[model samples]
Target: MSVKGIQPIVSEYHLLWEALQHYQERLEKFSSMSTDEDQQLKYDEKLQDMDGLLRSIKLAAKNDYQLDLK
Candidate 1:
């Protein structure tokens, strides 16, 4: 019931936030399972991808819709 069909995209924004949180939780689990420093570093690198994606999403929201995330 959005005026211009924007509701779905708005929902997508929130879902992306949830996805980011879920990814962080998974990263924490991976860290806990890593017993050595080198093992932890490997998992740490995995966050770079997620962080990059989040930054991109935030930028898109602001630039495309002038929406302030969070």
Candidate 2:
């Protein structure tokens, strides 16, 4: 594939990374919630989303593209 085609994927990877980071912060807040059941559910969902994003990042990296989350 052309470098041009890879550009959009790279952009998407960056967006997903940003979203994962945000979800992580939300997860921390959820952990501190007094409501156990509801907060735990939200935290679990966020964790799953973060895992999915990480997996996507790994797959993109395997394609020899730089995600560069930093």
Candidate 3:
């Protein structure tokens, strides 16, 4: 495909990534504000899990598609 064909796909990927990052930040803020230890722990675990997922996705994009998600 030509560069024109790839631009939209690249743009979409970046937009999706930005949205995911926004949600992650919001989750972190919510987690920090929580007063309950147990809930905070759960939120922390979720954040870690999300971090792993994001990293995995970024790596896959770079390795498989040669796309730099950053």
List the global CA lDDT of all models: 0.72, 0.67, 0.74
Candidate 1 C-alpha lDDT tens digits along 1-70: 2344444375687687678869877987897798998988877887777777677777766766666666
Off by over 4 Å in 2: 1-7, 62-64, 68-70
Which candidate tops lDDT?
Answer: 3
Which RMSD values do the candidates have, in order?
5.8, 4.6, 5.9
Off by over 4 Å in 1: 1-8, 36-38
For every model shown, what is its TM-score relative to the native structure?
0.67, 0.53, 0.73
Q: What TM-score number comes out for model 2?
A: 0.53
Q: Which pairs of residues have clashing backbones in candidate 1?
A: none
What shift in Å separates residue 42 of candidate 1 from its native position after superposition? 2.6
Ranking by TM-score: 3, 1, 2
What are the clashing pairs of model 2? none
Give the higher-lDDT candidate: 1 or 2: 1
